[model samples]
Each structure stands twice: as C-alpha cells, then as structure tokens.
Target: MRPELEPGHVAVVTGGARGIGLAVVEALGARGVGVLCVDHPDADTSAFVAACEAAGVAHAVASLDVRDRDAVRAGVATAADLGPVAYAVNCAGVDGLHPASGMTADEWRRVVQVDLDGVMFACQAEHDLLAGRGGSIVNIASMSGHVVNRGVTHAAYSAAKAGVIHLGRSLAVEWAPLGIRVNSVSPGYTMTAMTATNPPEVNAGFAAQTPMGRLAEVEEVAEPVVFLLGRRASFVTGTDLLVDGGFTAW
Candidate 1:
C-alpha cells in the first residue's frame, strides 16, 4: 500500500527545474508536500513555481549552484522559512564521458564537484533544520555506480556517484539516532533531459540490455524516491535503491 501524505511537510529538491528533478517535484507536490525547487540561475525556474501553484501546494524557487556552500546554505534557509524541511532530494549533477587516458583534470573535478561535493553541501546545509524533527534525504546516484557500463565511458561520473552512495550510508549512520534517514536512488537509463542528449541509437542499445527491455519513464524512478521520502520506507536507511529495469541483475 502507498503511504498517506501528511500535511505540514516540506520537501526541497535540487535540479528541480527539469527532467527527473521536475518529476520528483511533481510527485512530492501530488502528495501534498510543500516544495522548494532549486535550480541553476539560468534555468526556467518559474515553471516549477507555476506548477506548484497550479497544484495548490505551497512552493518556492531558489536559484542556486549546489557547488557553492554559501548558496546552498541560503537556499536551505529560504526553504526552512516555508516550513520544517521534512525531505531533501539532491538531484543536481553532471555527467562527463571521456576515455580515462585522455580525461582532463578539470573535467574530472567538474563532475566530482557537482555529483559528490554538491550532495554533501546540500545535506550539510539542511542538517540542522532536520535534526530535531527527523527528515528524509534521498540523493540521486546512478546504476553506473554499481556496475560497469562498457558502452559508455564516464569514469568521473561513475566515481562520483560511488562516492554519493557511501556518503549517504555514512550520513545515515550518523543521523539515524536523530530520526533522520539518509538513502539513495540509483536510476538506470531513464528518459530524461540528461539521457535525451545521447544519440537515439545509444539509448536503444541501453534499453536492449535491460531485462525490462525499455528505458524507464521519469515517473518510474520518481515513485521510488517518493517511497523513500515517505513513511512506507520508515525502516529503510543507509542503503541505495536501484530503479534500473534490472540492468544490474547480470
């Protein structure tokens, strides 16, 4: 059974302007949770705010670069002012695909900074607000973190995602006593703006390898995140939830 939505809960989602992030925002809003959509400065953030308004859920948008510590702190503070931040979903990340031998140091740092360091900063900024009340944190990792994707070379992305899983696990251990649950959702080839950049044939190849024989819909992955953030997974923490269409089964 699906868990019931409780009123007075607020959820903050990074990268909430589009793709999987937007799907997560809609999901949380559908469950009656107030939402704060955080996106980069140039993104069309007004759409997110408009959607929330249409849904009749309280909402706000903050332009933030998760890599900026001060910006993350201020963004979290702004969200907290709306209500107790009961949930945080860190979905802001970048993908760098290059041959390991030819990858540049800057390329590596860019992926790691957004995918790994950014998650840590967002979580840390919201830690105090979630402390006494206990909240849920769902970090968006990737199936690449658990298995090698020989078709695509993304050494930096995979490495940073691996770090994300460990970061969530460690935070779970430290925050469980305070009632805060930290978990991760690792999605496989899903149909999102990120994956949309891939050549059609490339996406098809990934679909063929999955047991489910198709790429995932945005909502397919979003639902898992909603579950993790809701009461249904009250006992789940310090673990990674794989929504990969069985891609890792082999």
Candidate 2:
C-alpha cells in the first residue's frame, strides 16, 4: 500500500456522498485512509456518513458546490484538519442530455460548470494542500470524452469530460516537480442510483454496445482509482485509464 493510502493520511473526495464518489470513499476507508467528503449543500450524505462510521475511518463532510472556487478551497482546508492530505478525487459532475442543436447557453453552461469547472476548482484547492507534501489527484472523467455514445446526445457532457482528460495531463506536467501526480479515470455505463432509474431496455442497449456485454459496477471503477491514488502508481502520471468494459475497444 502506498504511504499516502495508509491509515492516518487524509484524502479529499468531491461528490463523495454518492455514486462513484461514494464508492471511492468506501475503497479508501477500507484502506484506512481518512476522507473529507465534499458535496453539494443539498446532497443527502446520510449514507456516506454511515459508511464512514461503519468503516471506522476518520471522515468529514463539506457541503458546498464545487463550482464555487472559494468554497472548494475552504473544503480542502477543512480536510487538512484531519491529518496530512495526500490524495484527492474529483468526481462531482452533472450530465447534459440535450442535443447540441437545441442546447441553450444556460443549459450548456450548467453542465460545463459542474463537470469541467468543478474539477478545476477542486484540483486547484487539492494542489495547494498537497503542494510541498506531495500527493495524487484523480479526476473522474467519462468514456464519453473519448467516443460519442451510440444513442446519447450529450454534447456538453462530452465536451466537459474531454476537457477533464486533458486537464489532468496539463496539471500533471506542471505539478510533477512538486511531487504531485495527476490522472483521470473514464468509466463506461455504470449501475448507480442515477442509472438505476433508467428504463431496463435503455440499460440493455448500453450493454449490447459494449464488448464486455455489460455495464461496469461501481466497485469496478473504484479499485482503479484507489490504485492510482496509491504508491503502486508512483511513476504513473498524466494518463487516463478507461474502466469502460471495452466500450471504446470497437
């Protein structure tokens, strides 16, 4: 296990209250790493709090929107109180389903703000926390960034995620001298609360398109994130790992 992943070291995970973010928190807790969960003010964190207690790991919650720069900085500072902050995962994001032709400016801005801008704000704050101490940062991007989904029309989401993938590479270069490695994980269709709400046939279509013939599990995506955040990936940086069940293989 990486020293950064061992017990006593803290990690800040945005969108930690649910979905992939929550899964990452669980994975980190199982590794004995403290987690500072940053989510929207209105997000329900009961489950997140319970998981942390069940895992018996040090945990804290910062209820603030990631789009706000000052709020993100304060959230990272809050995580610093637990111990040495060594890792961070930015997973707070929103999807835009509207087609590019009919997408309004506000609609486009909303998705880009939360998906791309949010990641940037979180990264900036996390960088400050781990600057001299050295650490790892993983931004949760999507395979949508790589290829357009067969039946989906989310231009904004795809654009924002594409930005995230490159953003990690750019930051990795600039921060390497400071000992901070940056990377991204792109997941295929995953069964989460949001996806679970979709019609069964809708999900089946997703499965049919993937070479793996199935959607990815939340845990499946979480493990790679843990690996990237640990010492095992010590020399790995400026890359994007696709945990997409071979969705892009074809």
Candidate 3:
C-alpha cells in the first residue's frame, strides 16, 4: 500500500468500470483505500470487483447511473457502510460528436445531463458524506473544456465540460469552509475505448500535435487524482490540473 493512503479510508469513484475511472479506482485500491466503484447497470462491474480483489483491497460495487439523483444518493449512502468516503472522483461522462446545426435536443440534453448534472449529483452526495471528514473531490473535465476542437463538433460535450470546470471551482469555495476540497483534472486526447474507435489518422494527428508526441496513459492521469485525494494536496483546491501532454501548449 502507498504511504499516502492507509487502509480503512474509503473512496468512491464514478464510472469506475473502465478507462480512466477504472484506473483511478485501481490506484486508490492499491493505496489501501476501500473503494466503492459506481457505474451504470450495463458496465462490466464484475471486472472492476475482480481487479479490486486481486489487489487485496476491500471494495464494493454499485450499479448506478449518475444522472439519477436518487440512485446517486443511495449509492453514496451505501458506500458509507464500508467506511467514511475520504475521496470522491466524478468520472462518469459521455461525448457527442454531432455538428451544432444537426444535433438534436435529446442528444444535447443527454450529454449535458450526464457530464454536468451527473457531476453535481455525485459531488453533492459525496460532499454530504465527507462533511466532517474533510475529504476531497476530483472532477474529470477535459482539455476540450479549455480549448476548442476544430476536428470534432462536440459542442454539447464541450459546453458540459466547461460547466464541470466552473462547477468544481464554485464547489471548492463553497466547501472549503466545511473542510472539503474540490478540484478538477482536464485531459487531452487520451487513448480509451471511446478513442479507440476514432479514425486512426485522426488519433495519430492529435498525438503528432502534442509536444510529447504521444497520448497520456491512464495511469498518468490517475496519479494526479490520487495526489489530490491525499493529504499531499491539502492546500490545493478550486484548481484545474491539465494532463494533456502539452497538447494545449500550442
């Protein structure tokens, strides 16, 4: 176990079934934090549970869609059964690549509800649980929130992510007095299941444009999130950490 996180501390990770969320869950579990992995009913939650068990970490799994307020509240309540939730990572989100003119209302609403509203729902629940414990939250925004993507017309996604960043900043101030810290992590062109289906040339072009000439690995992003959740970042709050491999440098 990592020296920063000792056993018995609990951390709840939304979208923990896979990708960056899964990586964060693993990182926390490896550090001896009891993890509560929340995801949609359709996600491969068994895999996450298996991984946690393999890491010799205590964990629980909940099938939840973060967009559902009642479900989110209930999930957080259930997480308390394990221990105090010392950290909450909001990583459940969706991406829509439709042109602004062609995007439908439902599509726009779905993206916003999942990315923005869902974040609020999770944060509120987790904040309630961590009220006196002085836990931290790490919301997963994106580089798209800070910069426009000319190749993809992800207007809805970009707008929602922008809201997430602002929401994190606001929560940081609102919760600071309560001893709760809030922050955000914005990633750029990371390879994931969603990006795996993107055009090979498009992905290559994005990597080429990065100063590092590569996409960030899931672990690279997870490490910062873990740091924020630990005491090492005790004084940090209301800030956005960009882990884009210098993609935003230009």
Candidate 4:
C-alpha cells in the first residue's frame, strides 16, 4: 500500500494554476493536504481554487514572481500560516522554444530566469519552512534536459532544466543532514497547456516519436511527483525520475 500524507501538512507549488502543477495540487489536496498555489501575478488562479474548493481542502493563492527572492520568501511565510510546508515543487517555467539563431538575449534570459533561477529562489525561500520539519522538494525538469527535441529548439530551456537536475542533486547532499530530500522529475510530451500551444504537426510528431506511441496525461506525470513528495520516497533524493513515455530511451 502507498503511504499517506498527514492532515494539515501543506505544500507550495509554483505554477499551480494549471498543467502538471495543477494536477499535483489536486492530488495532494484530495489526500487532505493544504497547498499554496503560487503563480505569476498575471495568472488567474481564482477559478482554479474555486473548483478545487469542492474537494474540501484548505488552499491559498499567491500572485508573486519567482524571480523576486523577497516575494518568494513572503509566499513561503504565508503558506506556513496555513500549516507546515512539508513539500515544495518548483514547476513555474516557460517552454522558451525558438531557434537558437533567432532567440534574442532577452528571450534567453527570460527562460533561464523562470526555469533555473526560479527553482533556486523557491528552494532558498523554503529553507526555513522545511528546516525543522525535514520535508521534500521536487523540481520539475524536462526530457529536453537529457535529449534534444527534433522539431523544437530551446537551448535556454534545455540548459536551465539541466541545471535544475544538478541543483536538486547538490541541494539533496547539503539538505540531507536536515532531513530534507530533494529530487527532480522530467516528463516528455505530456498533454498540458504548455503543449497545447504547439501546432497540430508538432503535436503529431511528438506522438510518433515517443516509444509509447502517445502523449502522457497530466496525472501520469503528477503521480511520480506525489510519490517523491511523500514518505514513500523517504530514502530517495538526488535522483532524476523520468516520467517520459520512453522518449529519452528512444
């Protein structure tokens, strides 16, 4: 049987408004876990939370930019008021897919900032929240971190995800003493708002290339994330779990 999370234990999920992050929130919330939905100021999380309210779990929404360290810290504090933030997942990022040649310096910075630096800022801010509780941290990476995609080119996105993997490993080593486990999850072509932006040709191509011959559902990717955030993964850290449909293997 799978281990169950305790009640009143809260989690912080960046980009919790939709996609894989939204799925994670719903999963954990259904298990009686309080969660803080942290997303960009422009993201309208109000409706998402209203829908989740039917699940009968406590939740909060923080409209803060991950690039701002101070705002991240404040969000952590706000979440702590609800309950101990026993789990945190940095899922806020953009699929900055553009040809390397046409990708301007600003575009590169934006991708790196959200994908890499955002994860760092979140973990740093949560240090105090997870210190005594000895919780879990999961950084959302991508299969692009391991293998380059054929149709899409996102040098910054891939590089930053690669950095996210290493960042979790490095932090796992340092935070182990504090009983904080840090790990990463990489997904290939999953059905989410991010992938919905792609053209039909691009989506079809991704499906054909996957060994599974299909794209993954959001819940499929969120399950492993929940596992890593729970007691089941108590001894697991510093590892990258590929939730890809054998995309990297192929």
Give the number of the best model, judged by lDDT.
Answer: 2
Q: After superposition, how far is residue 111 of candidate 3 from its true place, in Å?
A: 0.5
Task: Quote the RMSD, in angstroms, for model 1.
Answer: 1.4
TM-score top scorer: 2
| 1-250 per-residue lDDT for model 3 (tens digits) | 4477657788889999999999998898788888898899899887788878988777888898889999999887788888867889989999988999999999999999999999999999998899987889999999999999768899999999999999999999999999999999999888888688888998898888889998888999999998887878989999999999998889
Pairs of residues at least 3 apart in sequence or in different chains that clash in candidate 4: none
Per-candidate TM vs. native?
A: 0.96, 0.98, 0.97, 0.96
* Candidate 4 lDDT by residue in tens digits, 46-160: 6559646866777898899998889998886788888777998889999887899889999999999989999999998777799996999999999998888886789999999
- Please, what are the lDDT tens digits per residue for candidate 1 over residues 1-250? 6445565688889999988898998888888788888788878877688778877888888898888988998887788877778899999888988998999999988999999999999999778779988989999999989988967889999999999999999999999999999999999999987889889989989999999999999899899998998898999999999999999998
lDDT ranking from best candidate downward? 2, 3, 1, 4
Pull out the clashing pairs in model 2.
Answer: none
Candidate 1 segments whose C-alpha is farther than 4 A from its true place: 1-3
RMSD in Å for all candidates: 1.4, 1.1, 1.4, 1.3
By lDDT, the better pick of 1 and 2 is 2
User: Which stretch of 10 consecutive residues in model 2 shows the poorest summed lDDT?
Assistant: 1-10
Runs of candidate 3 with Cα error greater than 4 angstroms are none
Of candidate 1, the 10-residue stretch with the lowest lDDT total is 1-10
Worst 10 residues of 3 by lDDT: 1-10
Q: What is the C-alpha lDDT of each candidate?
A: 0.89, 0.93, 0.90, 0.88
**What is the clash count of model 3?**
0
